[model samples]
Target: MNVRWHNGPMRLLAPLRSGATYRGWVWLILGGALMMPFMLVGAIVYNWFHPEAGFEGALHPAVFAAVIPLTAAVSLLLPDREVERTAARRLLGAEFASPADDGTWNSRWRTGCWFTLHAVVGGALSGVTLGLVPFCAYLLIQGARAVLDMAPTGAYVGWLPDWGLLTGPGLLLALVYLVAAAAAGMRALAPGLLGQGAADRLAASRAETARLAARNRIARELHDSVGHALSVVVVQSEAASRLIEADPVFAARAMAAVGETARGALAELDAVIGALREDRDDARGPQKDLADLASLAAESGVEVDLRVTGDLASVGRLTSREAYRIVQEALTNVLRHADEPRASVLVDAGEEVAVAVASPAARRPRPRPGGRGLIGIAERAAVLGGTAEADWTAPTAAAPGTWTVRVALPKGTA
Candidate 1:
């Protein structure tokens, strides 16, 4: 604990600054020692004198504790604030190029603890060991200083600080007192600063996990239930269209299939909604992947052209899921924003599977799904370590002016 305590200021003052080392910590503690004596002494003495001064002492320690760390803090804010920057960066997996508003406590509280640790240890050493040096030497040198200071004129001879074993030992004892005080003071001031940061990181993790689970559950339930029902309903409807002229009995069967499919979909949706009654942490969504997309498009009356090169069984869930989303989003874009009522989709799954959607441009469709689709595309690409691009293109004679959406997913989501 003591070593850990000292390291905080070490990190702040003279931390390893990237390729360089910062030895500013010694300066931070020593300088703080020299400057804070007045405030610390006054606070200590006042507390010793008055009962009401307890709160004053409490606030005073932060002020005193802040000084050394503050100096170190300035060094960090300097053109070379790189060491502490790297430490926090690694802790949070943050970017140095971007602003680090997150490591506030990492820099502040940890640093303050270090300064206090140094002061306490240094003061004790000064009192117990260094203090004895002067005391031991005092029998020889104690009275010598006054004698040396004695002037030819008796004016200076009358008044002088005692240069004796008495004063040396007293100063040493005072140093010891200050060290103990500093340690206790730091404990009072710096606890939970790091804990708070850790809590924030944990909260973010929990939140992200919860969000992911919720979204996955919704998606899986929709596909397994609503999506399957839609598939059955569409098939039955098509059968009815063909058979209505030939046989009313077969037509009735087709219409009944629609009702049963829709009911089944609703039942699945309800089952998912019921799962929310369990602990949120217990929620689990069955994994869905790219193998399911072709069926999804077909069920929705959208034509798809899928081409696979490399085996996808080697591909993991995260990559496969992201690729599925890319296809889903692309098709959504074509349905809602494409210039033509019909669109073409081609997915190539080699080392990379590229999904591109193409539609004629002259048939102006309603302006739609700009913000949400783009954000979802970017998010999917980011999650999969892939990328997506969309553009409006000038048409060739064979394929007149058209709009195209393309997404590329790598085998490895690095």
Candidate 2:
């Protein structure tokens, strides 16, 4: 282990370096100001028990001295501790390990215990500092007079420390250490009184996880819904351009389909954005399911063969939504990346719903390891206790090399 020079006198001088001394001064002054009312009340109570006063309820002087300061100190404990904790953070640079809130009365009572200890220690330090002032003043006068002569009527000098050459330097050093120790003592209790425990940390972690999950869900919704819409708009616009002069009526129909698709896409986008607003739970997702496959097939610019083999209505809402998204994403991929725009979708609904989309692969590129599309497909399936797979295979003479995405989700998941 390596030892550093700062651990030497720097440890003693730590308060001065970090401005803790200044903070301690502020804390002391603030605490004293707040304690004044309590102290005055205690004084009045003590005097109310005085012999000079004609009141029948009189207490002994010894009891008054013992009880008065303790009563004042206890009365101001909570607020005083809060002041000290703030000073530790601002002035002494205390770093908290975890969060603490407006805690319970039990925690406040614990803080009061800490404050009582502080009062006792701090009161003694204040008394020492006060006593030093008179001593220092007396020493200065004795040093200046130079002659150890008695007063005109006196035979001996008053009770003063035997003057030595190092006395001044020694007294100054003691004062410095007294202030430093007081500041250190206050900072030492900060973590015990102000830090959070294990339960608080766990709650904070859970909240953070919930927030991240909601953000991811919104991102996935936008990507699946809006991306599919944009892909439809692109393909329909291209098809319309090729057919407009040769078949005006069919071209006009395609353009109209584009407008409808755009409107639905905008609504889906609005729904997703609205979910992020204050009334999130009231915001509904875009209504979609395996039954929409026929309309989805119609919107595609190229040929689409969509087949359904099982009872679609038996599928619950969440599974149907996932199935719709899977096909939408697959068709979007076909339009965006495939050399040929034609594709096939198969829905086999049973105890588990299986969905598949196949299209000719793009000319040059293949799926990479971390494409968001494939990752999202896998995530959707996994969320419903299912699985997704994507692959590209060698070309067949009958058609071409194809890219396929498949997902299987358990039935009745909502």
Q: Which ten residues in a row have the lowest lDDT in candidate 2?
A: 55-64
CA lDDT of 117 in candidate 2? Answer: 48
TM-score of 2: 0.74
Backbone clash count for every predicted candidate, in the order shown: 4, 0
Q: Encode model 1's per-residue lDDT on 1-414: one tens digit a residue.
A: 999999887765442232221122232244345344634655676577677767586345454554445444443333332443343333322232322343464645454444444444444443344445555345224445655764233222222233443555555545444444443343344333222355556666788999886776566445534554665576668878999989989798768767765765676566667665553534544545777766556543344555545567766667777777666666555544555445677766677867787766764344454336555666667666788877776767776877777888777642
Q: Compare the candidates by TM-score and give the number of the best one.
A: 2
Tens digit of per-residue lDDT, candidate 2, span 1-414? 135665777776665565567666555545444444444555567677674654322323343345445744464445444554665577656666534554555456556655554554454455455567566656655644544553322232443433522454468567756676676776777676665545567778898999888788888888888888888888788878999999999889889989988998888988877778845555675478888889888875557988999889889888898888878877877788788888888899887899889887745356566557877888889988899998778776776777888899988843
Residue 375 accuracy (lDDT) in model 1: 55
Instruction: Return the TM-score for each candidate structure.
Output: 0.41, 0.74
In model 1, the worst 10-residue window by lDDT is 18-27
- How much is the lDDT of residue 292 in candidate 2? 88
TM-score of 1: 0.41
lDDT of 2: 0.69
